[model samples]
Target: AISRWPNRVDQRELRQSEIYKQGMQTRRRVLGDTHVNAAEVQKSSFDAPFQELITEAAWGHVWSRHNWTLRERSIVTIALLAALGHLDEVAMHVRAARNTGATREDISEALLHTAIYAGVPAANSAIKVVKNVFAQLDASGE
Candidate 1:
């Protein structure tokens, strides 16, 4: 098979790259220290590569972009996750939305769009998740 690029970078080297470092910073900023610390504590050799991939690609390459504010990205991410029936991820992002400057109203509007574009069921489920997370946040005074 023909390859697009002959060279393949090693995972170890990629982890040490500047983008990875930037991604880690962005991830911690967005997800918060507690979430990142819990994830790190749960990481094992089995999922190390997957963890690095998201850190470098999703966080570094995409989230780090300056064109859109984190708030905007948070709205879009919550909608997409809701649309895809990823209720767990929707909850996680909903929690992260606070740090991204996305208000509860923004999330509600995004879910409305999700209901129209994705499906009623998906949006309903996401709404439940959002409510639960919001309750937790409120209880914690976060």
Candidate 2:
């Protein structure tokens, strides 16, 4: 694979490091293995850097930090992404939310709060994504 070593890993020693393995496991746990797999699947000749940047900043740098619990980060993430219409990032955070103990109700309330401050259309679109995620998670029996 052309894209494996995450941020903060020595490019040469990542294969033998416990920290690298733990970081990837953390990424998989919070963002879902399937999502990570799909990203790997789509790594192209030119777009690999984009995915790597996410692993570095989002997963390695941000998620690896202890500033907040994953649940709180998820709440802040979903609301901010919803407000800014970062639809591309919504699913990852939603899955992270589920991993970190955010419920469907919690997501709904965050969206509601987002609506008042971020505009109804943004919240509306985000809520739709939320419903679809819950439905998919339920369908998978998880």
Candidate 3:
């Protein structure tokens, strides 16, 4: 099948676009320099396009929007990831929550809502992920 995305030249232009720059900033802010740096270090040609797509679309377009604060987006993202059984991402966002100013109470409350709406198993699994992440954070004194 024909690819629907732009050609390589256009994709190169997009990498230099203002939105991509904004996304990188927002991504680094939310995920932290350590995590973003590790991800960048691990980036390879195979997944480079995927990374850029998410950086531009998710971070730049949705996350960088002014309608909600970073905390709000962080909570929502955690809930959605949990709902979709994206437990690894749930853990990631839970760690990012600290940077977004989301407290443990806020995350607990969000998980409560996730339990009611997304189901018990999903929320339960996510809560476990959160606990592990929290333990790591506490140990690191972060």
TM-score of each: 0.91, 0.77, 0.91
Determine the C-alpha RMSD for candidate 2 after optimal superposition of all C-alphas: 6.4
Query: Tens digits of per-residue lDDT for model 1 on 50-103?
Result: 999899999999999999999999999999999999989999999999899999
Model 3 poorest ten-residue lDDT run: 6-15
Q: Per-residue CA lDDT of candidate 2, range 7-101, in tens?
A: 56554344434444555667888888897898789889688657666666667777777889878778888999999999767876887787888
RMSD values for the candidates in order, in angstroms, are 3.6, 6.4, 3.4
Q: Each candidate: what lDDT?
A: 0.95, 0.79, 0.93
Better of 2 and 3 by lDDT: 3
Candidate 1 positional error at 98, Å = 0.8
Judge candidate 3 against the unseen true structure and give its global Cα lDDT, from 0 to 1. 0.93
Q: Candidate 2 lDDT (Cα, whole model)? A: 0.79
Please rank every candidate by lDDT, starting with the best: 1, 3, 2
TM-score of candidate 3 on Cα atoms, chains taken together: 0.91
Per-residue lDDT of 20 in model 3:
85
Provide the lDDT at 98 for model 2: 74
